[model samples]
Target chain A: MSMEGSIGQDGGSENWGPQVTRKSLMRGGLAALLVAPWTASTLGAGGGRESGGQDAEASGRTRGAGVTDDEIVLGVSAAFSGPSRGLGAELYRGATAYFNHVNANGGIEGRRITLKLYDDGYQPDPCVQNTMRLMLEDKVFLLFGYVGTPTVTRVLPILKKFQNEDIFLFFPFTGAQPQREPPYGDFAFNLRASYNQETAGLVDNLIRIGKRRIAVFYQIDAYGRSGWAGVRAALQKHGEKLAGEATYSRGEKFTGSMRKQVEILQGVSPDAVICIGAYAACAGFARDAVDLGLDVPIANLSFVGSENLLKLLTEGREDAGKYTRQLINSQVVPSYEDTSIPAVREYRELMARHDPQVPEELTREEYTPFAHSFGSLEGFLNARLLAEILRRLGPNPDRAGLEEAVFSVRDFDLGISEKVSFGPDRRQGLQSVYHTVVEEGRFVPLDDWGARFA
Target chain B: MSSASSGVRIRRLFQKTRFGIFAVFGLIVLSTSILCIYTVDTELTAEYEINIQNIAKTIADSSVGILLNRDLATLQSLVDQFLDVQGIEYIYITSESGEFLAHTFVPGIPEEILASDHGSTEPVERSLPGMGDFIEVGSPILAGVAGTAHVGMDLDVVALKIQRAIGQQVYLISVILVLGVLASIWFVNLAAKPLAELLAYAVELARDGEREDLADREILSRDDEAGHLARLFLHVARQGAGRGPAPGVGGRE
Candidate 1:
């Protein structure tokens, strides 16, 4: 088993082409001595990859944790279970679809993007814990694609705590103000319109339709409070106040009854009701509202996951049309059916071709993901924008230079009518809030508010 | 007298008014104090259990929908809110399939709890290794379809409270017993003082063979049985040998 015996045995049997002489052995030793350090340095520089080399540009610049010579890893914590599972699952599916496409087509400067995902089930504590693990344990290059406002609001403080590490979250899927306002705003980059914009648009459009008496139904959490504040501010502009308000605890299910909330809103006799909640609870409220014979225009925000809300409302009911009628939703992303836009067409093709599944560990519930949705489209846009920023960072990206690169993106087009922009003062990339209504089991753009409601 | 009669005499001594009152009152107060302690212990234990059961039921009801969806994070959050209630030590939720979905246990669940059967619907007394005794109550969520939520109420907390109550009761009993003994002694001395003076005067009268009025004015002026008895004794002693009535022999009558 000794090296000399094995060599002698092999040499005695084969009598190989090259004969070993003292001068030849001395020359070989000298050559190996000269090459060993170079080989070691080359392997170390290539991030211990089996591929002996990396990009010439990557070799010349500094890198950060989770950014290897050939890979860039991003961490994500989203609701992969619970009632809002579809939102998280589909969003993840959409982003990974784009990342998969990018990885297939030579990646970003030959460094493939890998998303390290954990399921927080849309709870703040778990999301915070997952964020800590992502930064401390996993050492992800950046936090990306966090879902839900409550989860993101809780994680903002954590980003502040580790500011010395240059840790930043990129394009978390929330429109809450915590990451867009002062104190924590600098730590996060947002791609979605804030809840203020969404609610203001809903309130203004509802008022324009002569529905002056508006009641609000919201989840009793940070997400709900943010949307409520938006509605309050918009109402104050017209010297009006909310007609009435009702709230439901977060993580409520579609199977749960919402008759109490329906009665509360109905008691106020509002002409329209705007709901700030997730899909399951919002769908339940809408269902119960129709059942209770209180017919009014009910609006939901983009975070409500309109596709999932519609599915939950219509899946088992024979009179599904009644539940969806007079329902309006505010979305940050454009409609996926609108192939007129270049990004929409690309998103559709890539989504179909890739068809990514939710990670196996995160899928505890039996949820059928959407083929295409506003949530998924938003996720795709987020991934695409992040890819653009990463590309702008050139081959060697550092955490320290992320803010500069993001701020450099001024009025960049993502193939949509609305141009994406970021600045030193502005943390949100998108400011447009699009309105939609359920039509023929799909959400289409709402063009004329007066015709629809009046 | 035979030993049995002698024993009866000794019992009669204790059956006397002063001795009997002290013995009876003490027995009554001591027994009453003990009964009160027993009642309080029973009531507090029952109340604590009922409080724990009500809390467990509430938690189980709220956990039903979350458990049905298999949302562990929400369930964990739900159970965490109940930890601030007094006597609540820990809470752990099990899935319908008998897997632990959420637990408030730090470090880890004890081997005793992990090894024990969690199928009991009633409260089970558990003794954890490092965590002390607990009254583990389980409420079935969705009638056991969504699994069961188990709440551990610390028995050590209840025991400590009961011990404090007993200490207070002992202090009260001691004060009552001491007060009862002092009151009994003073009452006996009050009643026996006059009788003792009358007995001594009678002994001196018999030994000196002199007819003298009772010197104790208080006893003589009592105007009741003792005064009447004193006047009659003086009258009888002065007229024993003379045929004529010695009316002045009974002085100050």
Candidate 2:
């Protein structure tokens, strides 16, 4: 299949609040706000105060990292143009949509939030360079919504280097164990449940349903290994092991890797296949499985980008192979279609209200798809959590204050299934995971699995 | 308010003793540590109760087949995995009739669990201080038959974890307090030293009716509370004896 890793899973992955502060424009520091888009070029030279030296009690706004009197600027270094473009682009859009919505509603304590992005192009090497630029050159208040495992691996060491500066990297778009584990995770906070939680739900559900001969299809990298290890652990819980396994190289494009995997998987004819890769490749494997008359269901981990993979599997047709039925994609977030959850409804309303434009190539329905994307939905969830935490920082907000505020978010409801929480020793958010099966171009919850297609 | 001046209080014999000072601050440190541990322990217990319930739910949620097929061997082995997990007391499965089918513990059901309707997967915690602190979770194994999965977790694990965390924090707090005590002791000595020197100079001047330079006492050069007291002492010594060095005793160096 020529459509390998290069193909965008975009079904995957803001604003200068005022890059430069208008010094004493109003008699009071925060009495009034300038309703203007912040440009990064004129980053205020006024916040010359030394790091952690300026106490919150010293002024109305503590000057450190990306905070100033009027607004806070958040920096991101994710692939908006390359392999993981979908995840990066959608995550940004989702967070920005919420930020814009908040700003329109008078912002946090009258200080608006701004997001600045550095395109790492889904490559780790660029991640190293781009993070430096974001940290030193851009001086974002905090880094948010980073995408990809390779990128996070490079960012962690650099994060440690600048740890003393009181900057927190919030909600990186990775479930890789490294970011969730200690030491590397000290400066990191995660919004999504880890891949381990996702795969455990997937493998456990499958095993419960009598799918004994479980196989795995994974990308050949840390991301793939994370899902693989989770599946192995979950199976071992059932006193079982993997029936078969296959792997594809990272960032490898259209390289008959799916064909080789199909050849390897068909021999064992596993009862179910748990795939961990980008949408294009995982969809290719599922498509080839269907074409080859492999009757068993081919499930994918959340990393497969549910909608992106579904679009590829269905290819614009609702009834292709009855194939969508055979596909079970585990998710870190609830399905976009299930609007009963307050967070999901808010996500749809906020997305539709704030960012109404759909890309020209997509049909209105496909672009919106029950008016949601799993990636955007997740992004929206993260933004909501971020906003709630920022609100808890009170009037004199700083990175240190923000960290304290985040830790105080105990059992805070995010309107979605998972309750967001943080502690002095706890960093990850949303321990709960959900599973979905595709039905007519939509991902329906797995608990609703048998009833719909019946 | 006890309006006795702090100077008089500090000069009191009991207050000047190391044991008295340690008792005052040490009680505060001990009380604060105990209060913090109590608060943290309560929060950890609540959080872990939910965690144990969720774990039980996850186990039952994944056991739909074993329970459906009535596979006792798989059930025992599956629940056995949790045996090695810290804090879990027992994992038991029951038939629709409330009979114990398989268990990680001995071949019996707890009288407390068997007394309730095992149909509900809802988790309940019982704090039997002498017996054991336990959270028993029950999940429906079958749709109609009402077979259930039960897991009981001991809350002592969470208490132990909190104790360890608080223990580490208390250790650090003790280190900081020790340093603070040592600093206070040095400061108390520092204040007493300059006072003693000034008083000795004042006595010598009053007795001999002669002026001596208190400025040579090093501490008088440094501006501080002691220096201010030293200057006052010199003035008092001159006033009590004579304004001009008794016309001959010494020059104002």
Candidate 3:
């Protein structure tokens, strides 16, 4: 009853005057203005904002893992013993060539760069296992140059889990969108151009020359899908798209599934066929195509492992010279013949000097072809970038510091004409793409597209 | 007195001094409420559009590779996966020449959505009675051969959300308005307190004439109706004091 009495009857009080004031009016107006933006921003989180790798209670004081007084152990989980091993092996050799030289120079601040390598066989599950072991069991300071899209996508949740500990993954080799964008990009650092960019270049060049009826042959998996998506998007940009398409199941060996794919593509009679698969699989398709009298220009994305594809097409064949000449491949790294480029020159010098056993299967002596490789060149560029960041860490190093140093690599040149840089939102550094064709059993830049193979 | 007469008196009293202030307060409350409700509505619509737009884009961007490689099972699976997402009406992929390649909706999409081309950069929006509102986004499978995709999304969820938000807004605004009106009543009473007290003291003076401390001169100088009444009473009181109040009170002294 007392509580009822305290509130009183609403109509009991006779309303009079003096309640309204200028100040109350202003306050009400201000409240309305302030609450709108507040509500919008609060709800914006459902969709906006980059995913994962945010440290809620971040401290920059602790040193990074796998770092020591005399040595820094880097983790590498690539396809060391699988279908993509040629690419993986070549990439590691390229990075090691640079690391070996740096170590011989007494290393950075008397610390040698050491690698702890794992073979993931280019599979997703194995990649996850290898990455976790490298991070949790092996305690490697950084994860670098792991190949393939399936592996990188599977490694996303692990990266997010270790976000609080400031685990910075450096440069997984696949250019899939997942590793380039949020949730996965939180800890992923990529140095190569995306499959999107590579395919765009291919579509542009093909369209530029009036090659309207284009076909695509791809591997049936994430890697194949990424390249297929890129080419599709690029073709769409010019109001064009794939004329025909065919896919081989993942792990399908060269020429094994080539007949079915060739039949589909040959039926279309396209002016050009853009191939998206590993070197062996693509090479098998090409060998089959040439034999079937489908003599159209064939272009493979950079992910096809260029040198290995040529090796696959040429080796133990009487018509090796004829088979390779019809092949065109996109390159993220420039031609290995151009000595004017500092990065290319550095790669060639490092490979020849340090990893001299690396072979060059050249058909012509037009330029210094000593250990020339697109994959190794990419690896070399990745290493040069890593060494630059490591030197910036001073004597004391930690994951947080490494992350900071990673972003601080602002517009710094590593010999590419396009300035390489990193920012808060930008995870990948290089955007420029190049195209090449095989001439005289060598990967020749596209400027010499129709050069006759001797 | 009858209840009707009492209500009449109350109405008349309210009309005299409280009407203007009530009108102003009522207007402010109504305007603020409308503003808040509209703001909430606009924000909700924006959020829905942004989310739908992003979904359309992500699907279009992601579908290219599978669509181009002619991965039928995977393409259909992707289509079904998108269709499984909440509020997705249908999704379809077509060749550059308008041939249906892969689609989630059977009997296929309507002619309107199917007519979309890769030439347009922005998503095309439409509404149908049974299908609700829809946004169709097209992405070209540019590199494979010649294919484009169109994804249709249902916007009935957005409309439902807006309706629900409006109901909440009305409820919240009604409560705030009621509380505010009550507080306004209290505020006006406080402002009128001095006038009420002056009137009561004047009544006491009339019952027992010539009280020295009854009149308040400061209130007479105020600019309100209470001040005007106070001034008139002081003038009459001065005249009475001058005329014969002292002679009447002499015997008592």
Candidate 4:
């Protein structure tokens, strides 16, 4: 409920304009009141529902009983309208395609999975509203593919309140620190590598390259703070303090502010630069650094991934190449650009059949497969997990029973990614990361960075 | 004819002279004022649109990098960052498959995203306010990853910025217009001074009955409209002078 936290999700900055005008401010206030009661009622109704099929549903053999004789529903929330709208849409596409394939495959347990999607716009208030709507009005059996750190963070409390009531939130897209920790973390599962793991892997790689004196350029936000903490922890293992650090507000386009930080790093003349920013800002920093004649090799977390960085450099291809060639990134998901991977092949086939219009040329880009692979893998895993829980739900199942079955899952593998196992203390259920570098505008796996973390 | 009738006619002629000069000055001032306001408004509006377009292009360029890279987290961060920018209201990203990915306020997933196959893993037409419909850039996440990254930047902010800029320009233009009106009045008076003097002399001659020298001095020298009017006035004055000349004409002797 902190305003700073809320700012990232609810278009908090949008309040400025309307607040400046009394007429619009009054209108906004009225709309909030009108929407408030509706949201409350929806949440109240969702909370009141409980099914008595717990015993039959908890046995771990139902496979697909969540969609039964009367209902077939699936739910998802993605950044439909916010900053990460592009990625949200891609993730949605991947999920939708999988659902299409499922529907085309005659569905599971003799019912079509009707996917009910809500646009949280990558903000929490709407995410909570949409989640409530999905559970109450849409009556989805479970929530799958929710995205964003602040978004997932906001809805966690509500989701936990409904946890015992049979609403299961699964496979959140963010790997924020608290999301991977205990207490606040429960019910949801994360397939992506935790920020800690990603940073640890990145630090390990930097050390392997014999690079010392690291500088961190990060967005001044939770995501950046989390990555910075991880970097600090990793650096501690080598007994080194950061050489230089600079921070910028998220979405800030100007690099002038970061120039001072770049100068500090240049003074130290670090061999590697650890940039924790979105594609544009990071690229901006890189371009700015190169402009200032600082040619350090750059490494970034999985947040930058490969596709975004390449696109960022594409504009300044010649300039970017001079510095980007030495760039490295850590990924939690399999590299889609690596066709040698079986998962990538299956994902490619799925995209072709269910969504053929997705350009075939994208396969050439390294990060294209990465996004597709992660999204497809998430869909495949969520489906597999749901199916496994359903099979355990027996002949008749309800929401509570589904939660029990899902939490009981141990050493489950969907063939595309790592085996997922969860216990009373462990809710995230997956912890692995892979390191990759951009070569010829494609992500090529360098090594299994997860093993280093372990 | 009575002496009183001639005196009354002379007074009436003086009144017409004042009215005619004022009318010419008013016409010049009004036309110039209207033209100045029109030109300034047009230029201001055009400049406002151009500024908005520039902002839009910047947003688009940044968005392209975010989308093509499939960096949702960074993209989300960018959205929050841009929220403070003068003219952006919301940002939305959709995948090539028409899957709503992330948005500013509304969750990217809606029933339409699940039901419609329009995006179908290909870059499709997506509509955004201000920017209209743009083709969502379809960047393959990886070799196997296929999806479109649809980004919507609410240009309302840009539009609003332009609006504010235009508002300021309007205030400035209003100031300029007031000055223009006053300057036009001063200029008209300065330019019409010589003509006013010529008309006064012709009126004096009509009253004084000065005839013999009036014909030569009062003839129109040029074919321009003002010159023709001058000649007509002189002819009328000469006729009046010729009819009653002897008293004032003794000076010529």
Winning model by TM-score: 1
Regions of candidate 2 where Cα sits further than 4 Å from its true position:
A1-62, A252-257, A317-322, A356-371, A448-454, B1-253
Per-residue C-alpha lDDT of model 4 across residues A1-454, encoded as one tens digit per residue:
0000011112111111111233442443322312233222111100111321111222123333234342345667665443344445456556555555655554455444444445655556677667655544345677878766667765666666666555667777767755555434566666666887888877877776677577788765556656766777789899986776666655554333457657756876786788776655776677678778887677777665346556666645655466466567777777666566665676667766655212221112222333454445555545545656666765566666765676688888645557877776667666888777666666677664333222
State the lDDT of candidate 3 residue by residue for B1-253, as single tens digits: 1122122122344445566766776787788778877897899877765765676566666666655545443454455556657767776666666665556542224445545564353566777544667766655556324566556666676667777888788777678777877887777767556555556545654664466544434554466666566555655665676743322223322
- All candidates in order of TM-score, best leading: 1, 3, 2, 4
Prediction RMSDs, each to the true structure: 20.8, 23.7, 23.3, 18.0
CAPRI quality band, candidate 2: incorrect
Candidate 4 chain A least-lDDT 10 residues = A1-10
The digit string of per-residue lDDT tens for model 4 on B173-220 reads 557656765665566655454355455545655666354554444323
Candidates 1 and 3 compared by TM-score, better number:
1
C-alpha TM-scores of all predictions = 0.62, 0.54, 0.56, 0.52
**Which of the predicted structures, 1 or 2, would earn the higher TM-score when compared with the native?**
1
Query: Residue by residue across A134-229, what tens digits does model 3's lDDT show?
Result: 665445678888887767766766788678867777877777777676545778888889988988887787777777778888765567667777
Any runs in candidate 3 off by more than 4 Å, and if so which?
A1-63, A255-257, A356-370, A448-454, B1-253
Quote the chain B TM-score of every prediction. 0.79, 0.72, 0.66, 0.41
Candidate 1 residue-wise lDDT, A1-454, digit = tens = 0000011111110111123343542452322212111111000111221222223243323256757666676878888889888888878878877887887787788877766567888987677767765665456788999998778877887788779988898888777777876667899999988888998999998998899999888886667757876787789887888887777878999999889888877878999999989999999999899989989999999999999999888887787787998899999999999999999999999888878777454566798888899988988999899999999989778888899999999989988998888998988988899999989889999999999998
**Clash tally, candidates in order:** 0, 12, 18, 66
Q: Compose the digit string of candidate 1's lDDT tens values, residues B161-189.
A: 88788778877887888898788867676
Better candidate number, 3 or 4, judged by TM-score: 3
Q: What's the true lDDT of residue A219 in model 4? A: 67
Label model 4 with its docking quality class.
incorrect
